[model samples]
Target: MVLSVHEKVKSERLYKAFDLMAAKDLDAAETELHAGLSDAEAQEDKVLAALFYSSLGVLYKIKKEFPKAWKFYEKAEKLLPEDPALKLISARLLIDVFGQFDTAIRRCQKVLEISRSDPPFLHQANVTMGLALLKKGERTKAVSCLVDAMQDDFEGLLSASNIDLKLVEALLRKRSGLEECRAYLEKALRFAESKQEERHVELFRRLIEAFPTEEATDVKIQM
Candidate 1:
């Protein structure tokens, strides 16, 4: 249908913009997004407009234009007030880049309240909340949130190499639970094996190797 075609075009445009952004062709990326935004406005398609706005936010964030990014993100949020995805992304930026831990936690709580039915959303929300709590010196509650995040999408988390890599490092550094971290990496290795992802397999292998093994003194012989 016409709508599907429009969506496809919009999606392709968005991807192309992001690809350019990744390549550091900032001007071209901005041009692409702006053109798409104009088209969305011409169509009176607020959803697509919001999509471009959010993308602009990401682009500006990459350019280290925090205020511009925040403006675009807020514009998108206003257009789609109940959007948990926007909250998730904005929360991440607020906490990691802006160091607005309290605001990020508030946004994460909103995501938890609204995105319970979506496991990925809930999982990310929990992880973000955990990170925010950790920043606020609440380790116990942070660990609890991280545990909930792990439970929410263990398989999905394991499958994502970069995400899982950073998360595993964080867990190890924070000592969220060393046993759990090792076990998680073990499962990630298995997932890599199943998918025949050689890079992931090797990465997980090295990570698991980096973990300290059981000490000989901890073992006792039975008479």
Candidate 2:
């Protein structure tokens, strides 16, 4: 399982690029990514090249350079057409950057179809699909997808995110059971508390306040 020198160099560059990107040093990040891409190309490793391209796509997307992001994603997809993770990224970009909900939902569905054994990817695909459906005015289906995502999230990671809040809001708007909506909001509240997300904490607090005493009491907050 030892990596060749080229793979080692490529991996190091990619990791550095990711760190730089996290620090908001976009120019340095882009340079490191390009260096990785060059090494990957020199090695004739399509998988490595695809990975670098996908990273570049995300970097450009974060910078709001949609065209460049799309171009890099397209290149990545061409190299790894069956990659579920890349497909999920492309779907997210389509929904968030390109406003292509239908296309994004289709891409997510495709990923879900192929990524049955990968629960983390499945959760992400479902969340992306739910978001796309929500944007498409299909609240009922959106709620279904979001619920599926939350149910699949055995680690509770996804349930602690704003996606849970989105689910609660959707259910409330649909006049779902008071206890059901409270349950989601409570999960969100715990997540906010854990992350020290004050805004989300306040939001959940306000939503919980709207519920009756019995329903609020029924919603248990996890420590």
The digit string of per-residue lDDT tens for model 2 on 123-160 reads 67777887788778887787777667656323435333
Model 1 agreement with the true structure over 1-223: per-residue lDDT tens digits: 0111122233567768867876889889999999989888898877778778977887898789999999998888899788776576666656664566887899889988987666666767877887778778777777677667667335544344423233345555665556665676676677778767898788778767667543311211111
The TM-scores, one per candidate, come to 0.56, 0.49
User: Candidate 1: how many backbone clashes?
Assistant: 0
Quote the lDDT for 110 in model 1: 93
The Cα local distance difference test for each model comes to: 0.68, 0.69
Q: lDDT (0-100) at residue 124 of candidate 2? A: 72
